[model samples]
Target: MSSILRELGALVIDADLLAREVVAPGTPGLAALVEEFGPGVLTPDGELDRPAVASRVFGDEAARRTLEGIVHPRVYEEIQRLEAEAPPGAVVVHDIPLLAESGRADSFDAVVVVDAPLATQVERMVRDRGWSEDDARSRAAAQASREDRLAVATHVVENTGTREDLRRRVEEVWADLHAR
Candidate 1:
């Protein structure tokens, strides 16, 4: 969706990408995680061991909260800097995965959720990302509920079908955003 939006001339600020930056080696976010969860979460070369960290945090609420505490603020700060740097009146889209969970759904002019059912999400994660089914399911379960996401969504792009279908849905949503 973000890729499509970028092609369509929206300045899309991807929080997932920013999340990676905030926790890159030598960053304070990584330091905090190492302090809280220990050096085991780091690779031998000193980059974050993402899979190890995900395996630790996804199942445990406290661990997830700890990870968020170290990461979200840094991501937010980068997002603010990026938004400020966008062109005047540009159609900037903040592609945030945790808008509902972070209590910032109401902050956007329009919330476009690229929603898929749990089975669809799980299947794609397993097939495309090479994650085990249970791991995919568990990761999906950790996020905001489908209903909660829908409640905040001003537009919903259903991603249950093929890539072409997703592109079409995204295009329609893109049109709606332009209309607004």
Candidate 2:
């Protein structure tokens, strides 16, 4: 990814880092954990009982909205900062996983969807993170569907390939971006 950014005369803007930075120091992680447990589960002490929290926090829609309100602004701030810092003639690829969720598509020149089959994605997630099938499926379901992602994508990167193939495609895209 770094190589492709260099080749395109562009700088890399990591969405995850931006999101993490946007959250108030330590609060984002707490908020994220609260979100996972379904809100309000974090006692002032910070120890989590996953089952108890999931039953209470996730069951309440108001709690979910409150959680989003706290984090979204920070994420937006980081995104704006990164966009402002992009170098001249740079094809800034903001790798925002929640672009669709945020309804912020118009902010980018183009969208690049990294495509892979659900099964492959699940397998990779499980192998990499030791997540169970249910966990993998839930995570996948949380993201936009394949068709929706493809619809929004100006370029579809089929990640179900060898590293060489992926690199080749990235190079091609980088060359095109450079030409523009």
Candidate 3:
């Protein structure tokens, strides 16, 4: 969705990328994370050890909230900066994975959900990303359920098919965005 939106000349702000930026080495966000999670969150070289942080927070709601408290404000600041800098009348697309989880569905003009079955998600995570099956299932379960996401979605792009099918659906979505 982000790629297609970018191709159509929208200013795309990827939340995942922004998350990384906010916590990069030497940033206040990183300092806060280290303070909260201890030095173990950093690599020996002083870079943020993302996997370590993930391991620490993944199943712990309190730890996750602590991390979010440190990171989200910074990400939001950057998003606001980019949005302000965009040309007038430009379409700004923010690819935020946790829109539903964050209760932010109303923040955007429309919500586009790229969805697949839980089994397919787990399989892709295990096969394509080398995640353990249990780890993949746990991560998926942590997010908003399919029904919850669908209820908030203004548009749904089924990702249960081939790359060509995804491309076609993206094109259709691009056209619809333009029409609106």
Candidate 4:
């Protein structure tokens, strides 16, 4: 979806990239993470060990909230800066994973959900991303359900088809966005 938007000249603010940027080695976000979660979250070279941090917070709601508290504000600040810098009338797409889960679905002018079935998601995680089936399932389970995402979706880009199908759907969505 982000790639499609960028192709259409939209300004894309990716939450995943911003998350990494905010907590990169030597940043105050990383410093705060280390202070809270300790050196185990760092690699031997002192860079953030993302997998290690994930292990620490994975099933612990409190730990996850702590991590979110440390990272989300910085990400939001950067996103605001990017939005402010965008040219007037340019479409600004924020590619966020947890819009519904974070209770932020209403924050945007429109919500475009790129959705695939749970089975397809698990299969893609295993086949394309090299994740174990159980791991993929677990990750999927941790996210907002398909119904939840759809409930907040102003437009749904179903990705249960071929790449060409996805491209066509995205183009249709781009047209709709422009129509509005």
- Find the candidate with the highest lDDT and give its number: 1
User: What TM value does model 1 have?
Assistant: 0.96
Clash-forming residue pairs, model 2: 38-57, 38-58
Per-candidate total of colliding backbone pairs: 0, 2, 0, 0
Candidate 1 colliding pairs: none
lDDT of 3 at 42: 92
Q: What tens digits encode model 2's per-residue C-alpha lDDT throughout 1-180?
A: 545665556777776666555543356655665665444554555544444543443446665456557667777777778779887766776767777766777666777777899999999989998877777786677667888788787777788889888878878777766676
User: How close to the true structure is residue 120 of candidate 2, measured as C-alpha lDDT?
Assistant: 97
> Local distance difference test, per candidate?
0.92, 0.68, 0.88, 0.90
Quick one: ranking by lDDT, best first? Answer: 1, 4, 3, 2
Report the C-alpha lDDT of model 1 over 64-101, residue by residue, as the tens digit: 99899989999999999999999986888999998989
- Of candidates 4 and 1, the better by lDDT: 1
Candidate 4's residue-wise lDDT over 57-168, tens digit each? Answer: 8677799889999999999999999999999898788999978888989989899999998999999999998878887887777779999999999999999988889989
lDDT of 3 by residue, 34-130 (tens): 8888999999999899889878888998988888888888998998999999998787888998888888799888888999999999999999989
Stretches of candidate 2 exceeding 4 Å from the true structure:
1-3, 6-9, 24-65
On the 0 to 100 scale, the lDDT of residue 67 in model 2 is 51
Q: Which residue runs does candidate 4 get wrong by more than 4 Å?
A: none
**For model 4, which pairs clash?**
none
